[model samples]
Target: MDYYAPESLSEALDILGRGGVTPLSGGTDFYPALTPGGPRQSLLDITRIAALHGISRQAGGWRIGAATTWSEIARAELPPAFDGLRAAAREVGARQIQNVGTVGGNICNASPAADGVPPLLTLDAEVEIAAAGGTRRMALSGFVTGVRQVALKPGEMVVALHLPDPPETAVGAFRKLGSRAYLVISIAMVAMVLRRDGAGRVDHARIAVGACSPVAQRLGALETALIGARPEEVRVTMANLGALQPIDDVRGSAAYRLDAVREVIARMLREAGDG
Candidate 1:
């Protein structure tokens, strides 16, 4: 297999523009997907590119470099609003996988059970795409078109994730239901960001659910309904969670996932209110 690790973004883009090469970083997903003795493809390793390295604050919010690993995110000194994301980072895989699995790779892999998606959705994350032509940004929600699919066109690659500043008082939580405590794919997962008013009523709420839909989805209707409710008064019904379309699988049944989400959402709201 041909391997090229470019040290600069321009060089990386140039190679990608030529086509017939796969962009690789960390290779946590790539290596696992390879079939032994299969037709070998050339690899364009972008990890050495300086531009895609760390997490930093920009004018609007924060920028997480595409090559930043899950371990970095889990240990970063971020705010309370990032708690859910950090939690997801810690749960991405075992310590070994977390050390090398890039958040960018997680998003680009576009798995329905991806631990990062629900938290990122709640953060309103944006995907920054780079190419030989230039760069562009898109909402995370629209970037992952379906299971194992992304919106990148030819010669395009994700460079970083951009998040807008959220309410200073916002707090986030994440919950996952899996067969085991560690190293298991989620049966269902929920992430939420909550901000309260002076009267202790919810002012801002963003809720997302994963492994229960084609793509993780924000509970827009539920978020709207919780606007004026107190933490203790929060209620989640199957009707409010209409955004998710769960399917029966070996891990869980669609009905069970829906039930689990309601409970998780309720608990997260209560904890957010109490804290």
Candidate 2:
């Protein structure tokens, strides 16, 4: 196998445009996917590219580089509204994986159980992609097409993720129901952001469920139901998550995942209310 570590974003895109080059960020997902006879030939390492290596505040919100690791996100002192992301970051894997698994890699991998997607979707995040000619930004929800599938073009590479400013009254939480406590793929996961009025009624709510669908989806119906609802009322709204399409997989059955969604949503709402 051959390796090329680009020092700039343009160089990386140029390599991608040539085709047959696997773009590597942190290599957490790529290395594992490659076995004795796997389809990996050449690696285009982008971690050395300075333009794709940090988090910064941008025009509309924040821009997180593709190479930023989960460990970096977990350690950052973000606003309370980003608590859900921090929590998900901490649960991505053991300490070692967190230190090496980049947020871009997680999104690019496009797994149904990806821990980062739920929180990013709840934040209304956008993904920035660059190819040989230009760049484009697409909503995270639209960027992911299905399980292990994304809308990125053949020559395009995810450069950064943009997140809008969070509401001041916002409080967020995340919950994952897996078979084991640590280092396990989630059977179901929930990421929620709630903004309450001064009178304690929910002014705005964003809820997303993962590992239960083709792609992690925001519970728009549930979010709408929670509007103007009190904390106790929020729990009641969570009981109706059966509308989501969950599949029976090796990790869990469809019925169990549906039930787990409800339970995780309730737990997230309860935690958000406590803070």
Candidate 3:
């Protein structure tokens, strides 16, 4: 099979239009999932593309290039509003994996346990897509359709994630529960972004959970309920998780995952609301 390392996006897009290759970013997922010489699909190694790597300021918030590694994200000089994401970044894997795993790869892989999704969802991130045609954007929520699935069409790839400015009053927190303390797949995870009013009540809340559903989802009901709630009083019930459907897996049972996330929310609410 052919292998390519294009340094420019234009060259990569040209290669994509030819249609017989798979784009490989970071390879944390791609290399592991590769079949042993079966199919022999061409490989487009996009890690060298300069345009696809870095984080920059946008008009209102930030744009994180798709190839940006978890290490870079963890080290980025971001505000407190992004603390949850940075915390999640550090937990993507061990230090070595964090250095190699791309945020774009995590998103495109669409793993139900991906640690990056919930935090980014809390940030209200949108993905930028590049194709032979042009560039377009989609909400992070709409981009991941299911387990190991995404909205990419043939000849298209994720370019960057655009995060809108978080509320000035917002503070964020993240928590992950795994079979082991570190370097293990998630049993459950939570991310919270909360903005407090001057009266010490919740003005806004965005909560997301992973590993408890086919895709991580923001808790709209919980967010709505937290409005006007004092930080210590933010509460969650099973009703808040009606949208999620966790399965019984090696890490934990469906019931266990639900209970774990409920406790995660209860804990994160106090931490995140302190901002």
Best by the lDDT measure: 1
lDDT of 1 by residue, 167-267 (tens): 99899888989999889999999999999989999888999999999899999999999999897686788889998999999998999999989998888
Compared with the true structure, all predictions reach lDDT values of 0.93, 0.87, 0.90
- Can you give the TM-score per candidate against the true fold? 0.98, 0.95, 0.97
- Give per-residue CA lDDT, model 2, range 1-275, as digits (tens): 78999898988999899998888888877777777976658889998988887889877688889999999999987878899999999999899999989999999999999999999988999999999999999999999998889998899999999999988878878888888878999999998888999888888888888998889989887888889987555654434574478889889999888877887677666665665
lDDT rank, highest first?
A: 1, 3, 2
lDDT of residue 231 for candidate 2? 57
Number of colliding residue pairs in model 1: 0
Candidate 3 versus the native: TM-score? Answer: 0.97
Give the Å shift of residue 234 in candidate 2: 3.1
The residue pairs in collision within model 2 are none
Give residue 100's error in model 3 in angstroms. Answer: 1.5
Instruction: Supply the global lDDT for candidate 3.
Output: 0.90
Better candidate number, 1 or 3, judged by TM-score? 1
Q: For model 3, how does the per-residue alpha-carbon lDDT over 1-275 read when each residue is reduced to its tens digit?
A: 89999999999999998999888888887777768766777999999988889999989999999999999999999878899999999998899889989999999999999999999999999999999889999999999999999999988999999999999968888999998877989999999888888888888788899999999999899888889888678667999888889999788999999999998788777665554
Clashing pairs in 1: none
